[model samples]
Target: MTDQVEERVLSIFREKFHKPEVTIDSSFAELGIDSLDTIEALFEIEEEFGISIPDDAARSLNTFREVVAGVEKLLAEQRIANPPAAAGPDAAEEGR
Candidate 1:
């Protein structure tokens, strides 16, 4: 799940910032990403992932890795109530 989110995020950054080599651990500060760009990036991420990151949470993001981590955590919690069921007849019986 984290990997998927990370990949999506990196892709977003590449398109938004025109930097194709961005990695999960890249430092936003070192990369020279400004506040407006960060906000735009967040917006794009929310739209792409179908998630709303609170303003407070968005403010705490300092690095690319943190952003990915935040998204990963949000996605994990969102799936808590929808765990996948096992396969086969026994699984169908358990759902009753």
Candidate 2:
């Protein structure tokens, strides 16, 4: 899942800034992407992953990895709150 997140994010950077070499560890400021580009990237990320990043938290992210970690953390919390349905032969026994 982390790999998927990294790939999707890298694609966003490449598409938005036309910088295919931009990597996951690359600093946003050092990537040469302007403020508007960063905003657009954030919007794309939120929409793509269906997650909301508060302004304060968003401001703290300096690399694509940070954003991915944030998204993963949110997803982990969500999963714990609403776990998946049980299955398999032991399902009923486990429920008891």
Candidate 3:
């Protein structure tokens, strides 16, 4: 799941900047992406992953790893907020 998140996010930035060399360790400044670009990429990320990032949190994303971490954090919070429902007929038995 973490790999999925990182790949998706790295793709987003790469597409945004047309920089195929963008890696998890790449920093926004190093990539010549300013805050505006970061915010736009954040919008793309929110739409892609179905998550919301607050302005304060969005502003703190200075590196690609940070962006991935923030997205992971949001995803974790989402899982905690809305867990999957049990599906099997044995679900109740398992709970016991």
lDDT of 2 by residue, 1-96 (tens): 889988987898888888988887888889877666777898898888877778888778888888778888877776676566584335557888
Error of 3 at 72 (Å): 0.6
lDDT by residue (2-67, candidate 3, tens digit) is: 999999999999988999999999999988999899999999999999999999998878999999
Model 1 spans > 4 angstroms off: 81-96
For model 1, residues 13-94, the per-residue Cα lDDT tens digits are: 9888999878887878877888889999999999988788999998889888899989987777765645456644556898
List lDDT for all candidates, in order: 0.84, 0.80, 0.91
Better of 2 and 3 by TM-score: 3
What TM-score would each prediction reach against the true structure? 0.80, 0.79, 0.88
Pick by lDDT: which candidate is best? 3
In model 1, state the lDDT of residue 8: 93
lDDT computed for candidate 2: 0.80
Error of 3 at 27 (Å): 0.3
Better of 1 and 2 by lDDT: 1
Off by over 4 Å in 2: 85-96
lDDT winner between candidates 1 and 3: 3
